[model samples]
Target: MCSEGKTTPKIVRGEGGYVLEDVPHLIDYLPDLPTYPNPLQDNPAYSVVNQYFVDVNDNVAQKIVVHKSSPRGMLFRRAGPHQRVCFESDEVHACIVTCGGLCPGLNTAIGEIVCGLYGMYVVRKVLGIEGGYRGFYSSNTTNLTQKSVNDIHKRGGTILCTSRGGHDTLKIVDSIEDRGINQVYIIGGDGTQKGASVIFEEIQRRGLKVAVAGIPKMIDNDIVVIDQSSGFDTAVEEAQRAINAAHVEAESIENGIGVVKLMGRYSGFIAMYATLASRDVDCCLIPGSPFRLEGKGELLEFIEKRLKENGHMVIVVAEGAGQDPTVESMRSVDHQDASGNKLLLDVGLWLSQKITDHFTRNKKMHINLKYIDPTYMIRAIPRNASDNIYCTLLAHSAIHGAMAGYTGFTVGPVNGRHAYIPFHRITGVQNVVVTDRMWARLLSSTNQPSFLSSKDVEDAKKGATDAAVGRGE
Candidate 1:
């Protein structure tokens, strides 16, 4: 183990900005665990590669841009194949489970994991836990094979079939121990990953020789510490069709307003990117930044101004935008889903009705408004080319980390470099639009006002900082 890879694993440098926290390893508890040659060494695929294995000391810097006086900043363990592994191929039995909502690359992620374990290490007996975490004890599992998941990447949704909030840590671990499963691959969002972290602690406390690996999945792009979520690009790309359609609908009529709601519960990456990509958006709203509905220089005023200027305008709002209960009694009923995520009101419907009522009752003018909600459609499709390649890399990285005895961690890219991120660093928090260059660029592209005030900017900045600090970014 490296010097900084202590039990606490904390390293600080340069005015407390730089941090290095190593991921948990099997050696931390079971110090006598022996090492074996990595199975990739014998495979012909990586046989000729000279600089293949990643060093134990190799770390990816979290911050790319820092002052000259600043230290190297936070660093993460660089992810890839290791020259040595803690587990032999024949002794490994892996199980995969996909939890939370559906994302575009779920099938691709599942397929890649099965294929990577089966083809690279020749580890057979991979099982898929169907119906989310409950399937572990529900006896609703399926055997996974390379041939069984060969073409699953071309399909949409997860082949394992997913649900949310069935995380019974004790029962799940009991099932794992009974089945003799050693490696556990869990794919899901923040809540699901939080569950994974708890499971890891339980397994570690019981002194089980189990490796718990996580693959972060969220189309919302909210989970912090990673560059972006798995299906973010696909969601943003698929949103264009709705944006274009809204633009056409708005432009086709007099006093036209097209409202397209996208999927962004807490973060607004999808809505912002979709609005930026589709130049037809006159206004964009997200949950990170607050806005007023009816007032001087408010959202209604902006809509009216845009309509007067262009004769037709488009507004793009994330599903989670304007969720404040004080915002026109929009959220009268506050309910949560099985995963504990708040069930959001249809902002598109509420916003469209507000615009219609404001025009008809207040202004005594007729307006044509069209609402397009493509939230589920965007996430339910197959992964695009970008996500396909990314999911493959993520799957491979997770396999390598688990084989190298790195447990209780999730795998993702930090500042364009893939690294193993500890589960505690990423779960229960989120990454949101920081109202920095990206938000400014989106506002400039849409020609929209700040909508709220300097408070939103400050709050967004503070949220970004808090997330960075929480994730050790």
Candidate 2:
């Protein structure tokens, strides 16, 4: 065998078939072999053959060098220890921003981040990106000093304004780069998180050094991994309170029927949790309740029949309940509030009318209909103690991860606790679909009537038949 330095080994035929001589050991042959360079290392092309040697012309060669493309003059070098120290100094600037609809604990999150970065990490200059992604691009920003964020911890809403149209990926990255922002903290739900991921990719593509972090903020509690979202507990508490009050009212009126409608576009966590908490809810109708259009009509007839037999009824309905086809369609035809969310009052009213009409025509019995909508009320109450503590812990974990150089992650509270996990690990966070297991668990934990029961099934089917004939009216 003939070996050449920095070249592939060659075999030569001799008088004795083939002669094996000057054969470099396998370990010594690696340095001369072609290999790719590390993209992150400085002068990576030149810093090749770290620990191995090569054989050249039947002799052992100590050093074998391979040349490749390199950065030309004026290109920024990989950060050195001193350079990194200066670049990540206390003077380095950053900002936090919120976007879209108002979620619970937004102020708490912002306050914690501002305090932790400035007071604990010595990151002094932090700006708040107002109006979300649109603000980032339109130069809508506000300086967040320690004093400005002090009283914000107790506040329920976002101190920095938010908007849905704020996040344009390219424009946001350009703004970040232009501002020399070293770090950015984005607070929102899935939409904001996706936007953050896009911005990170664009910045890395441009070879710019910046870090982005995300905090989950949606009252719907649709995000995975985190068992609970910032505003969910508060919303649930409010829902339960309203439900309990309605139950009392129904009991007080002596034979009066009360219907309370809640907000949960697709997932029934809010309705499920509230129903579980209020053991007196006679019938709970949520999206994941195994009720089809036929089943829904059956349910209304069952209520009318029950009211005729027992003089009183209480029903809880999720906003996503009934076969509405689509949430947008439901919202469009629905009587919405100022924020464009479907008004639970309208839903409750429609269902109540149906129940009243069914009983009046079928039994010639007049029934009183009381519709109660607890949508906004659920978002109005102060956060529960458990929720406040959980939100604070989640905030702390998020900031800790960020200071430790973690990225592409989300912090949340799960199963009455707090935990941090990578964003991609969440499976799917955008859609508003409910997991069957969760729905089943919520139903099992509640005292509500099960659709699978023989009596419920029979009553529901009879009601469906009556509604189909238009005789239930």
Candidate 3:
């Protein structure tokens, strides 16, 4: 029987032992009753955050349902007790792969997974799949151990390397079967998780029992339902240096406009937080909160007023902001990356030129503008202390999920707790900045003219309030 796009195979006892009752569901691996009962119950190392681990039969309360169309949710429960893995340590072959763009905590997350598998699980056949899915078919596998990854967390990039393409699900599943890979840990963003979910589906269709898990790696904090993705804190912290530079440039010159473009292809948390941290921003633009190019109480008017009042201005714009109006020229020749994200038009340069043209056309005061794009610098830095802890939690939770026979899920913090979120729930959505909640606060803090209309503000506030109520906060 198929329900919710997944095959629901019932277990039955046969001459060959427990087997899937449906003939169509016959696979190489069969589910067995969990043994080594209470394996970690008395383990000394289970002292810290032991509540995260749960018995396989222990159903949890507090189900968070999301997206009625997809109809997926997570049960908040303990996801740990390192000793109680689903696969036999000496027999299981586990592989890990990283995909998509680099994030600040990729290495930290990789290190935690390697250490947990080698040290905690004592898994003898731990392998790293290099360059993402492409590594599966190619001869790019590497042997991993706790000793090999001991200090990798102190670094920035993933030691396993990562890429975005080669999403051939059938071929990937074939490689998994050929390599005897029972557990796969995928570290990536939405696209990578989607790929993992597809691979899981293929494995299930072929009646294979390989477990696939994900740890979210979105630096923009755009993955839906996740409170914070890894690298956001570090990105925000590193963006501050750029913001400080912009502030100094603006302050030192007459009518200088320091324009900064930050990463946030679909969301604007980085730009919004950086603006708040700088505390000297005259105008801020984000993808979620679009502003008029030239109108009363719009972006240009606010910048002009700020220049007249303070003789200098600073503006922070998310890379995706004003796509409809400002990016028309760049869109004609735009290309997509292997992960399928569009090459974003240079919004910062476009905005700076607009400011210069406005001053030239109107014969207003001459303007000095500096545009800065600090995306690469921010992405290359090591994880901050806060993100380091977050990555560790996600990694540990992912390992727990995989060892417990859970698949097609991404480990993330939800409602301030680390939990398992089904990849289907986060497949095509983004956690955009809540205008009523965050943008309102930003506007008030900056004392800038209201860019959002009264009706829009009211709706945003209502949405925020309803979300808060749902969270019981």
Candidate 4:
């Protein structure tokens, strides 16, 4: 058998078969199991691609394009194969990195990746890149092994740590080559995934054989066509606790307004789902649905009416809500994070102040408003049972896809199945709440006014008609 320096393995026809290459480093850490000829020999799926041991020219295929024949359209990601195999078990050296903000399931995903690579592929040289993209060029790396990460899933933050910004793709590629790494598993959100695509392209340009795979990790649940990303379910569950607290605080006082601000840079799935789960929410405000601040039966009138009838009310607002039309004029966009996401204005606090002013000016009742912003608390907790399982499955699928030679794609849940999707298709897009279906349900359950002004009512009617015509109803 040929070594790493050789192009291919030499086949011997006279002998019973070609000898398996001796990779002592890969086998030294594993236990001897004489009873089983091969741990994965029985399963063809996990068998080595170079079983024949012949010299063949390197021929890489084009990207794996999945096509479906359904009128209603198919799952954005569907079941598929990698179309090519890049590396064998022993010759592969892999690295796993996490980027962007904190999420509930980050640690679990890390543990799953380490365990799957070591246990399934017997990969010994697995390194953890620290502090996101900066860790690639810097001297910050953590050695990963099966025993080292056995109980990491029980924790919250990433074992390798993470950071934003610092997207030097060329330097990152130099670091990968310097470390002799052949496969990379990146767990992050949209911005981080875009950086991964650049790194993958640079590796190809350098004539190096490296596989890059991404596991989508959006807590906002805003990646298009992905049914659900890791950490979303856990975030929704944690937000419910805050909503419960708001309900209690609002009920204890007279004319109380419990305001909750959730984390959503440009989407509002967290706020929407939390409000839906906690039926105590009187009004749900999101980035997708805009409401009037003044006029007959508007936000002020709705709160006043609710106070007169029930004496207290709970209002849930997404951080990105009411920004474009209402809050943008009142507030200035001065700051941005390392990941390039604009720092949102404090909508919850602004709304609370406005409510207090309107009530004080009326001189009818006093306003006892309670503001709750639980962004950090929700993002720091360990993964719940559902998210833990979801993270583990995503990690396994990522390892399989990376070893199978898939590049520039992220593993996501599509139609309740783990599927690989190209990064470019979903990078700039967003998964928003369907107003007609989801907002209609929220309005019905909360009994809130659909539209506060004449213009809003006209827009709603036009939207309904457009939707009906599209659906051929």
How far residue 255's Cα lies from its native spot in candidate 3, in Å, is 1.5
Pick out the ten consecutive residues of candidate 4 with the lowest summed lDDT: 1-10
Per-structure clash totals for the candidates: 0, 5, 3, 0
Model 3 C-alpha lDDT per residue in residues 1-473, reported as the tens digit of each score = 11122434333333422221211111225555363433344446765653645654332223445446532332443345534555666766888899988899999998888877766666677899998888888869999888888888888878888887546677788899998898889999888887877787787777776788888898898877667779999999999999889989988998888999999896888998888887878777887665787777788888888899999988988998877786675556667887778877788888888888889999878888999899899998889899998888888788767766667677777666666666665555453545546777888877886577778678766766675454323
lDDT, model 1, position 148:
93
Q: Predict model 1's lDDT versus the native.
A: 0.87
Q: Give the per-residue lDDT digits (tens) of candidate 4, residues 149-265.
A: 988888888888999875777788899999999889999988887788777666766767677888889899887656787999999999999999999999999888899999977
lDDT of each: 0.87, 0.59, 0.75, 0.73
lDDT of 1 by residue, 112-191 (tens): 99999999888987999999988988999999998899899898899899998746678898999999999999999988
lDDT digits (tens) for residues 112-168 of candidate 2: 888766654567888998877778778788898889988776766687978664245
Q: Comparing 1 and 4 by TM-score, which wins?
A: 1
Arrange candidates by lDDT, highest first: which order?
A: 1, 3, 4, 2
- lDDT comparing candidate 4 with the true structure: 0.73
| Residue 471 shift from truth in candidate 2, angstroms | 46
Ranked candidates, highest TM-score first? 1, 3, 4, 2
Residue 25 accuracy (lDDT) in model 3: 15
Candidate with best TM-score = 1
Model 4 stretches astray by more than 4 angstroms: 1-39, 42-85, 325-331, 452-473
